[model samples]
Target chain A: MVVTQTNHLAGTEALLERGRDLSTPLLRAVVDRLAPPMDTVAAYHFGWIDAQGRPARSDGGKAVRPALALISAEAAGAPPQAGVPGAVAVELVHNFSLLHDDLMDGDEQRRHRDTVWKVHGPAQAILVGDALFALANEVLLELGTADAGRATRRLTVATRKLIDGQAQDMSFEGRERVTVEECLEMEGNKTGALLACACSIGAVLGGADDATADALETYGYHLGLAFQAVDDLLGIWGEPAETGKQTWSDLRQRKKSLPVCAALAAGGPASEKLAAMLAADAKDGDGEHPGAHEDFSEREFATRAALIEEAGGREWTAREARRQYATALAALDGPEGRAMPESVRAQLTELADFVVERRR
Target chain B: MVVTQTNHLAGTEALLERGRDLSTPLLRAVVDRLAPPMDTVAAYHFGWIDAQGRPARSDGGKAVRPALALISAEAAGAPPQAGVPGAVAVELVHNFSLLHDDLMDGDEQRRHRDTVWKVHGPAQAILVGDALFALANEVLLELGTADAGRATRRLTVATRKLIDGQAQDMSFEGRERVTVEECLEMEGNKTGALLACACSIGAVLGGADDATADALETYGYHLGLAFQAVDDLLGIWGEPAETGKQTWSDLRQRKKSLPVCAALAAGGPASEKLAAMLAADAKDGDGEHPGAHEDFSEREFATRAALIEEAGGREWTAREARRQYATALAALDGPEGRAMPESVRAQLTELADFVVERRR
Candidate 1:
């Protein structure tokens, strides 16, 4: 299938902006219900405040999931306003995971800011993350509709999958071998499940039929795989200035992301060499623990990244991303998509394109 | 108002045993749905498995919350089976908090066994806690009824309050002064809210009206306060063998538990002395951090406990427990209680008596 290379970046930006406009206020209002320090900490994590608690406008995120939720509602022939709860719920779930994952993964920075755990502490991180998850369900269940109930079940199931993915990812770090299929499965759980939920929850809340929601979910599932592939690529090759990370970040941390898994599974001389180097790194104790790998030099990370690329990891990942992107777009044209408004389909397609092609 | 001193411990045990019989299978089934390591970790936390993953019948806490739920359902004229979902949901939320609280409080032991974070790692603790929370909502939502939806909302709200209470409890540790009222509020949020929900959520699932649920919830709210008061007394003076904690445990940690707060609020000579000692302890760097107070001697803890007792903290706390217990029992005789079956009311009264009188 020939993929369109149209520059929908501007359109996607507008869509994300619209999503932020719709969801941010409700998100803020919900978070404000958190008691004292949790509220302040959540505000800091959302970039609504400086570390000192002064109000500031910093990058929260792209609001990609919320945008998808809003569009999915439109796809179900409902007004965007009908999907606000879904949008906010998914956004809350997304941020909730971000908070805990930052602590679990020992990530110090996100969106060019110190992580919640880093800024406040690990206890606050755990508590605030939990509070947000509870708020996500509250936002849905408070609607007191049958559709809202259905949407809550969907969001919670997705959350479990997201958590399952995290467990798998953490487990993979200790093992010397991880198959490409396993890596993809982990990514599917960690990132794909929630995205899939976000893509269809709006439709579910808008009182759409199961078929339409399923179709939108399928579209989102593929989009999520594609998004993870791109993210894996950028972890190694993207510019630090754009990505808000250092050079060869994943390689430096020895994360067994998609690219590394694919290349290790390739089984060539360079792949074997890469595997040995990684195994040795794991033996050095730094690989066993997160945030303990700072001893690796830039030159070492460069060498590892180059070996991964030479073993065809980079090329394979890029191709997989494009293939997934094509599949995601094809979902929008299927039988269920026929019922969606043409404008909604166009917006979803634009967003998918932006997801696959963006630098960060 | 005369309080009965009749012994109902035997009947309460039977009731709890029935609750455990009804809820454990379903709880295990739900927890089994967690992926891999999480399932294993949760199994370990629930005391169904040893640290080595072999089966073991460890000391899981008394099934107090589940019993409350089942009895609440009975109060609404529904069979105990009707409250199974509510029972499992509250139990899950309770365990979720325990897993996180152990890590945050740096408590290495629980119920004569190592805590989840102590046995597993902190990441597993956080992840397993999160998974259990998600599972709680899922179990209720999977029932697929409006009552189930309402119960889920109630559970989530209680969960949020539980988290809020934890935040307050943690913040209290670093402060030099904490009021009796503030301590009570923290306990209410941390312990009372979940108990309140447990007491009413079953009625909600059994299609009870707002008046019934409200009355039951009030009963639970006071019962929780009574429970906390007893817990505070035990924290200071209960036998280590029965309580599974060291002697003067709260004082060793320099905790501002209800007893400490009440003693400080008394304003007598002993209260002033106790305040000075605690303030000095706070300045000694141990109070600022949990698990960092090992330097305090046994004699030091004994002296602190004696000071608290001398300041009427112990007597006041015991009286408060009795007062709350009376209030809790009185709820069953209120107007809303008139609709409840006589047997259910008797069972609830029995449970309340056991709660305030239990040694552990």
Candidate 2:
């Protein structure tokens, strides 16, 4: 199989825009079906309205998950429109997770605005998440396709994994340390499962064979891994202005992200230094929990970030992200495997790279 | 149109037992598939295991929701087993709501045991609820039949309404007064929707025609309303030991149940006295929030309950319960209806009576 070089950057961006254009309105319509207060919270969360129920000028987050679903459908030898419901479903599920996640983490800001929980209250946020989840299932079940049941099953399984991952993530917070392997599995469940489902559900919805679905699922799983790796990197090192977070956000939070866990597992001199810094953090009266952000001074956050980097944790994660990205691309190459059309394959490859290399 | 007065109490009990036998293991299995921590929380919530993960002698819930599904399936002309998945799905959904509702309502105990949130904390309770919900949909979608999608849709719509109802219920807490109609609508959405789905889902899975499904849904909706009316009565009037609550539970908690709302709307002497008592409650430095339970002196609680009854609120609620029960039974008597087999009809009528009249 000859893999040719192609600049799918602009094309991929256009496809993402197209996917968002197609799915956002459907998602809005589905969420609008929620009862009064939940509908208002959902619309506000989606940036369609503000807390007072007035129209708001807000551009939503990048529709990455929905883009993957739509693109995968095309790769499955079907029109992208054939996968609109899948796209809508995945996007709704993603937002559902985000809403709950923001609440659990006690996050105040998201997408440059106050989180739903911060604005409406935690109870309302929980209900909104639930409504979105139900809406996702409802949309898929109404697809009128043979794959409807199959896709619904995939989405549900992925959602279960996501919940398990969240549970593990929360459990890890109270503990002093976690193994790298455990952290990896948590990330896979939290992030990878949904992405895998996104691709597989699209193929299933597009009437693709099982083999085709499996290939995209594999691609998506690895892509999700790579995406998290890059996110971990950004959490520690990306410019605050670019990432829309505080300086050294993950370090200040003492989150058990890939790099932090990797450094703790290194068990070397630099690792000792990082551990000491973290130990001091516990006694420093920061009053910040693992799942929440900190009001750390810039110097303290920078020191922790540097200590982890010196332990080579940052480099390890960056390399792993690259490796995962390459593996994802490799999974897409074969006569039987890379059965997707060239244009769609190029688009996926570009999208995969974006996941690995995104600055924000 | 011959509706005979026959004893169906024993027969209804047998059906409930049979439904529990069929659905409990399946529900357990699905919940067990969650990760360990979540599985533990879910098991505890379902009364399968103790908070310590030890074998505890705990009688499970009545399994009324599952029983509705199974019996409805039989009424729709299918074998009970054909509705097992539907039964499991509805039970799981019901428990999911219970788990979240406990958290949102700050309920410390349920079914005479500590709530999942009380035992494991709010975050874990939330995740467990989400997992159960996903598992419910997963179980339905895995059904190797045409009705899988249809059943999933019904459950989703019902779930959405349930969430909406909860949001409304929470919002109602902040207000000084709520209309009886608003209270009834909230009950319909929160409780009626799920029971309605329980009935309609079985009918759909049993391959019932649209007419049959709609009629059964109507029956379940009215049944849910009647159930709530009785529940509200128990909240204020039942023995604490039997009801597993404090003296005058709803009054102490200041829950705007049917009687309270009716009295508030009545604008009679009882209504004025009740309002004055509640106003005194606000000034009593109780710091009453919707979800939090209150500890009131027995005398105070009894006085409040007596005032509500003297206002005729209690009688009004009791009458409404009977009216709704009659309406629910009447829903089953049309020419194209009463499609349920004789045994199932008798069983259903008994169940409806139990809802309206049960002491605990």
Deviation (Å) of B23 in candidate 2? 1.3
- Model 1 segments more than 4 A misplaced: A1-6, B1-7
Clashing pairs in 1: none
Please give the lDDT score for candidate 2: 0.81
Alpha carbon lDDT at B237, candidate 2? 95
Put down candidate 2 lDDT per residue, B1-360, tens digits, no spaces: 123224555666787898898887788788778897888788778777888899775867777888889888888889888788999998888888988887777766677887887788777777888988999898988885678788888888889888888888877765668899999999999899999988778889999887888898998999999988988899899886677665576765667889988887788887898898777776664443543435566787888888888888899999989888898888889754565788878777878866775677
- Compare the candidates by lDDT and give the number of the best one: 1
lDDT of model 2 at position B38: 83
Candidate 2: fraction of native contacts reproduced? 0.70
Native contact fraction, candidates in order: 0.77, 0.70
Best by DockQ: 1
